[model samples]
Every structure is written in structure tokens, then in C-alpha cells.
Target: MTLPTPSTEIRPDLVLLAGRVRTGLGSAADAAETDGTGRETLPFDAVAVRGRHIVAVARRADVDGWNTSAAEIIDLGESTITAGFVDAHVHPLSGAESRHNALMLHDCETTTEVAERIAAFAAERGPEEWIRGFGLSFDMFVGHEITNEPFARAFGGRPGYLLLFDGHSIIASPRALERAGIDGTRDFGNNSSIEVYADGTPTGYLIESDAESLVTDLYPRMPVEARVTAVQNKLAEFAASGYTSLHQMNMEEGDLDVLRALEESGELPVRVRVSPLWRASDPWAETLRRMIALQGVSGRRWHVEGVKFMLDGSIDNGSAWLFEADTHGGGLEPYWTPSAQFTHAIHALAESGVPTATHAIGDKAVEFVLDAVQSLPSHAANTRHRIEHVETIPDALVPRFAELGVTASMQPIHAFAQRADGCDMWTTLLGRDSERAANGWRIADLDRSGAIVALGSDWPVEEFDGRKIFAANVTRHRHGSDRPAVDPHQALSPERTLRALTRNGWASIGHPGEGVVAPGARADLAVFADDPLSTDPDRFAESRVLLTVVDGQVAHRDSSLA
Candidate 1:
């Protein structure tokens, strides 16, 4: 039992966000008040801010008596204040750059629609400009070969490519292949491939990053000003969705410059902690040295914190490093040609005191990452690591996550791809009867096993809406859909899901208390129109985000709301 305490020394700041407060996850619910029916109710109703931290948290009546002569107080009535959300896994830099001026195709239901949209988009661009499209769904090519034939005519001899929802594959137009001189089969020495037919004719389907880079690398670079603005706009959307910090998963070229520029002019909408990517093709020593050099590099609201490694690609693209063959005998190869090299890099990063976030989607990929963790020397315990997209793993592996202290960073929004009958690309890849098929996601399993489970949107891969993710976590169903849940038993409680989106996000980064709303905690807060815990799951997904405060400053405020 505890009560609100206002600091006698700390004064009010530029703006005081006064409102109904939920201090933290069921924290200090003992404001010591009850209603006429004897049911307990929230006792606190205001949070005072001073500079970059909360100065005090008290009842609305008591807060009004504090020294507020210099503060601009914005009263938020009935708006529930909670810890701001943290998207533990995101690719903001690349997502923004790839989406800049690209054709949005995530909604096209059929191949014909995709082609028509591509054709229309291409007609507007100059003949010399390469065309780009993003988030093309796999359902469009369910029954057909993943070749560019159906869409080749749309390019009209222009070099163009459309990225799949998996972000691990791309269907390049015929002219794009010709422009890139991709005319024959080429072994990437791993799972990545040029993807050709028996006749050695390029099918214009590139798998994994290595192969996709052949054509995508030829894309014209956007100017620094344009890149800055694009990322700025993208991050604002994140803040508007109730996010106050992002654990960015990749650091590509020109990212640092854009971040610096955004911060130099003014505050960024959200705090960004970038984890630079380490590719399989990089030279071992040089790459490690360069990554270590960026350990503490930071600007106002952004910093380089960890290194991300892709142990395997997505199951949809037949690139996941599974324990055995998928339904089509694909999804059996690791992204790293010599798998031991990945272990070596992880060991080296641990020795250098830099944490790693490995993308492991299939059962085998998850196991291999755990094995690598087991082999780490005892001294490495000081360094924390996480496995992103623990999409599938056996029941036995569930307990191992907590035993090994690996945070299970997951994107619940990914479950939107699941279908009740199990014909979705992910489920189909793993046979309906396969034991591993029953192990997908398993976020609740990890949490129950005492593993720290962090939630995220994966941004461009899924919309960065925190509300939608919250609904997805509890309902195990697409918001507003009447379809039966994909794996209903694995759904987490609303209380647990809230922690995954808030405190666990900071815990995954070795910082726990920063996500809570306390006097000493960083002043990052989110105000929702409806109390998430009490609202219906479907309605909560569409709840209005009344305000978002980062560093004691309002990042987003719905003008319509008081």
C-alpha cells in the first residue's frame, strides 16, 4: 500500500499533464479510496512534470495547490495515463527509405491488381527512374510460381521490384533483372539465391538480402534532406501510435547522418536506440571492429546500443533455417554459410561487451541461437542478449528461454497472417500436423516460463500501431474479425500484455525502472481515451490516443481532445 508523493524541491515545467493516472502495472493502487458500493477506485488523477522527469504524482485537487505559476498545465480529464510503449524491434531507417516514393501494394488482393497498380505507378515515373513497391502480400501468389511473369508487362521495360511482406524476398521485373545483369544462377553460399529455373533462366525472384540487394542496390539515393524528412515523418507516426521509444533493429548507410540532422534541429518524436546489423558476408575482423566503434555513438534522442544479426530469413520465403524441411522441402538452410561463423561472431560481441539481437524464426534457428548462448563463457553473463521473432520452437525450448535469460522479443501483429483453417503461408510452410507448427509464437509460454517477453510492431513489416498489437496479444484474433483465433490458448492476459509493451521493453535493454511512471523515472507517458484494461479488446484496438509525452514534452496531442 502506497500513496502519491509530490516533491517539495521539484517545481513545475513547461507543461503539466494533469490527468487520471495509472502509476504503473497495478502499482500502488492504494490511493486509499472506495466508492459507495465499497468497490475500490483510482485515487490519483494528476502527474506533474519538470524538465525531463516527473516531479510529482498526486490527486488533481492537491496538484492545483502546487507551485504552478510558471507552468502551462494541460488538464486531461478521464484519460488513463500509463507507461509509454516501447517498440522493441523496428527497422525505421530502412523502412522509411524503402517506402519513400514507393508504390504501396499491401492491399492488392490479386496478382492482376498488383500488376495494375505497378503499371499505374510506373507511368508516373521517368523512364530512367527505377520503380519500387513495398509490402506485397504472399496470398497474391499462393497458387502461382513466384516469378515476375504476371507483373513483367507492368514494368514496361523499366527496372522495378516489389518487396514481399516477409521483407526477405522480392520479385524483380524482367527489365530489372536485365539491368542488374542477373541472367544466370548464382550461389550466395547460404540460403540466399538468384532463384532460377531448370534452364538456368533467371525467374526474377530473389530470395533473402544477398540476392535482393543485386537489384535494390541500384536504386537512386535520396538526398539527405529528403531522407531526413521521410524518417522524421515516419517516427511521428510511431509517437502518434503511443510509442515513446523504439529499439531500431538495423543501422544502414546514411542512417547516422539522418538521425544527427533530425536531432540538431529539434527533438525527435521518440527516443531511438539503434542496433546495427552485422551481415554474414562481412569480413569478420573489420566488421567486428567497426561495430564496436559505434557502441556509444549518440545524438540527443538516438544512440547505437546493440548489434543485430540475422541467423535465418523468413519461413514464407523458404529461407528459414528449420530443423527439417518444410512442406515443400524448403526452409532448411541457415543464412550464415558456415554456421559456426555466426557462433564465433556472437562470442566475440559478448567478449567486447556489446549485446546482440538475433532474428531466429524457425525451430532450428531458435535452437541454434540457444546453443550459441550456452557455449558463451561464464564471464559473458554481464552481457545481455535477445532473440527476435521466436516464431516457432518445441515445448522443451520454452523453459530454456528463461533458463538462458534470453528475452523473447516478439511482434504479436505478425499473427494477423494466420488463418483459422491453417492455409496461410507460414502455417502451410510447416505441415498442418508438424509438431513445430503448434509451437509458433509461444509468447505466453516464454512469459510463463519466467522469460522477459518484449513486444513490438516490427514497423513497416506491420503497422506500428500499439493499440492493434495490444488487442492482438490478448484476443489472438485480428481486431474486428469474427474468424476463430489461430492459437487461442497462447493468448496473454491484458495485464501481462501491458507489461510486455511497457516495462519489459526497457528490461530487454537492461533498463527496467525507466518505463514506469514514478518521480525518478524518465517522463515518458501515454494517455489513452479508454482504460486499456477495462475496455473490450476490439474497441481498445481503435481507442483514441489522446496524448503522448516524451521527456516531459508532448510529442502528440489530438487537437480535438482537451
Candidate 2:
């Protein structure tokens, strides 16, 4: 597995010396170059970078044979090079806010631990500053209700707002409730409720959309300049984790303006595919005009590719819009607006020649999205509609995605993190017999049934770590545990997992040659400290990104390089 040595006469624009390279291959022509050994054989010891493109990748032997003048060379030193990680569904703004505003609860094992952490965080901040935190789990608090009493006591008079890890529930203190102007009477749809005691006092616990909306309204968003700085910091974090590009899900027009400003000022370091949130109240003509006007806005740095639509709520909050109530007799309700409203919104987006990516979590919600897709005229295929978070799709509707040419954009880490809760929710909503068919991240099964699977991490909602995500996909288990592993037969191979995170993400958004390392492709690549393909899941999880190059520009590197 030795790379060809660099010849004294062979010079390249840039050279990346690595132990291995994993070229993202989506077709047989790309597949033929690698033997069944799952490794790439290159003739050069380095990759030559010219301006913002990779001019040549050659071994030392061929470097003298090709033009190498005016090139920059990087030595990887026994590491591996692969296509940069591309996250498809992320809330960059929220993720940035989480870096500062909220108490991070990503790995707490119990509710008491969560309370203690919030209490500690509140104690350190000034009295007037809002105490906001994220990543609380509903399942963790199942038996013990999330009352504001504990949070209020912990806050010691400071206002506290704790967002459930799913981002669908919120536990607010009495002060926060008063600040948001929400009383016990607010209706949040389904079992969605603003929890108050029998005394009619606000309980500080809000479920589903009501709770999420309250926190959103109460938290003073950062100014555009601050947001730009936060996003820039987030980009560095992403690059350090081996990502060179990301598709921002649910972006608003104002957010796009901020991104444009950053790009114009040469502050944006990563490529972005922006999907604006779509509302029914917007005039179709005006929306289309604005979308068309945004074409070529950032000279390939930013793209407005589609519209994001919410079809239903999350599974964790018991608002997933199931076909039936929970068998546990808790009166579980579906978390969607009226069916008529959803149908109208989907039709409008489809007819406007703009692609739509609907967030649907429950089987019933998936059905609603599918029905809407089926209702579209045959010409609607031109829009390339996608169903995001198809977490609990019915077995019967699985093939329909392929038949309709829809992309199943899913997050594999969600399955690993939420599997127990999701199964419990499904079993409660549908009977145990029905639970047998509930599927999560059935990658091979979905692809076999004719679906195009793309990967994403709903960042800030949950921590986005690409290595952990990829390891979860292949190992089907969290690190150091064999318990709760997914069906091994349905797990994806390491190579396929890489493709889903890279090329499939690009293809999902209508960008073709962006994720591969071949000639003529955008020079978006990540260099790792070890060969990811040969490493075990634990080793893969530990693999550090040594360098990130986007459009042939060095965006991130180990601190040692500085």
C-alpha cells in the first residue's frame, strides 16, 4: 500500500501525502478502479493544488512527468484523504447559539443530573440574563414530569428555558412564561400542552410546537453581525470535524442575506446549500420571483436549492401524528396541522417549480407526504421533491419513494440515539404486532426497494459529529456497547456509509461532481490521521481530521500547523 515516490523532476500544484485515499464511487465505472480490496492505487505521492482547484494527484514518480510549477504541497504523513463530509440537514444558527446561550445536555443520564447542570449554569450567569439550555430527553423524564418548580428552584429567580433534546418540547420557568406572555390556555395541538397544575398556574412545561415557539420568541436572537461571527466559528468547528460543505435546512430569507454578506466579505469558509422555509401565506408568484432572483447569488459558494416544509412533529414529543392513539391510553395525538392545510401547502410548493423537502417523522405523516407526492401531476418529478426524516415509514409505502423518484434524506445517528424511545412510542401508538415492522435507518433495505438515501445531522437539535454518525451507521451500536444494536442485515457497509454522507448528499441537492476526488470535480476534501476504511468503529470515532480543503483553499488544520 505504498504510494509512488515523488520524482525530482515531477512537480505538482499541490501534493497531499497520505497512507490511503477513499474515492467516493457511485457507479461501476468509478468502482472498477479499485479491486475488491477497498483501496485506491495512485501513481503519485502528493496532490497538487492550483488556486482553488486540485490541478493534479500523482505519485512522486509521475510528479516530474507532469507540470508542477506554481503548486503548493501538503504532506499528510501516513494519514488518509477522502471527500469532505457534507451534512445535509443542519440548523447552523441554532448550533451556533447552543455554543453560547444554552446548557448542553447531550449526554446526561438522568433528569436530576440535568437539573444540577442547569442550576450550576444559572448560578454563574447574571440575574437578568436568560438561562437557556438544550438537549433534554423526554424519555429520560418519562415518569418524572418536567416541572418548572425544579428549574425555578435551580435558577434561584433567574428565568430558565430548557429545550428538550428533540427541540419539540420546552420547560420554562415562571419568569420565562411571563416574559413570553403565554398562559395555561394556549393550545399546542394533540397531547401538546402547556403544562399547568390543577390550580391553573403555568407549570413551565410546554410540549411540542407551543413550547418550542415560546423559547424561540423569548430568546433575543443575535444581531446579523453576531450571527455571522457565530456561523464563522461553527464553520471552523465543522472543518475541524472534516466537513467542507453543509446544506442549511430551514433557512429564512434574512439568513440568506447574512450568508451572502459573509461570502462577499470572504468570511464564509465552507460551501452552503440553503433551503428556505416555505409558508402557505406567501404569494406563489412573489416567492418564485425571489427564488429566481437568488440564482447565482454567491458564485457557487451559496445556492438556494429548494423549500423546507414541516409535515409533522417529532416522535420524542409524542406528537408524530400517528394513525392511532397510543395503546398505553395516554391519548397520544398526531403533531401536524390539518391535513387540508398540508395538502394545500405541498401543492403550492410543487406547482411553483421549486423542490420541496418535507420533514415527516411518523408513519402517518410519511403517508401524508406520499399522498401529496402522488397527487402531483406526472410533471412534478421535475422538482425532485424529498422526504426528510422518514423515521417511521410504513412497510407498504417504502417502495413508493422509489416509484416517485423521491429522496429519503435521513440521519442515521437519530436511529441509534432514539431507537428505544422511538420503538416505545411506536409500540404505544401502534400495537406491539405493528411495532415489528417499524424501521429506522434501514439503509440497505431502503436502497434495495429503489430509494436514494442521503445522510444529514439535525444539528443543535442534537450534536452533529460525522465520525460518530458514520460509525453508528456501520456498527449499529453506540461505542463500547453491543446492546441495542440495529438489525445487522440492514446496516450499511463502511464504504456505502461514506458515499451516503458525501456523493449522495450532493446528488440530493442537484450537485453532481462536488463530492468526488476525480479530475474536474470541486476540490473539497478532508485529510484524516488514519485510514478510515481499515479502522474499526471505535478507531474511526477517534480519528482526528488533520486538514480540510474546500475549493482547494486550506480552511482548517491541526493547531500544530499554526
Top candidate (TM-score):
1
Error of 1 at 497 (Å): 1.2
Off by over 4 Å in 1: 1-7, 14-19, 27-33, 36-40, 480-482
Cα miss at 454, model 1 (Å)?
0.6
Superposed model 2: Cα runs more than 4 Å off: 1-12, 26-58, 144-146, 187-193, 197-200, 252-254, 264-267, 279-296, 328-336, 418-437, 480-484, 560-562
C-alpha-based local distance difference test score of model 2: 0.70
Global Cα RMSD, each model: 2.0, 4.3
User: For all candidates, what are the clash counts?
Assistant: 0, 25
The residue-by-residue lDDT of candidate 1 on 447-484, one tens digit each, is: 99999999998978878889988999998987766777
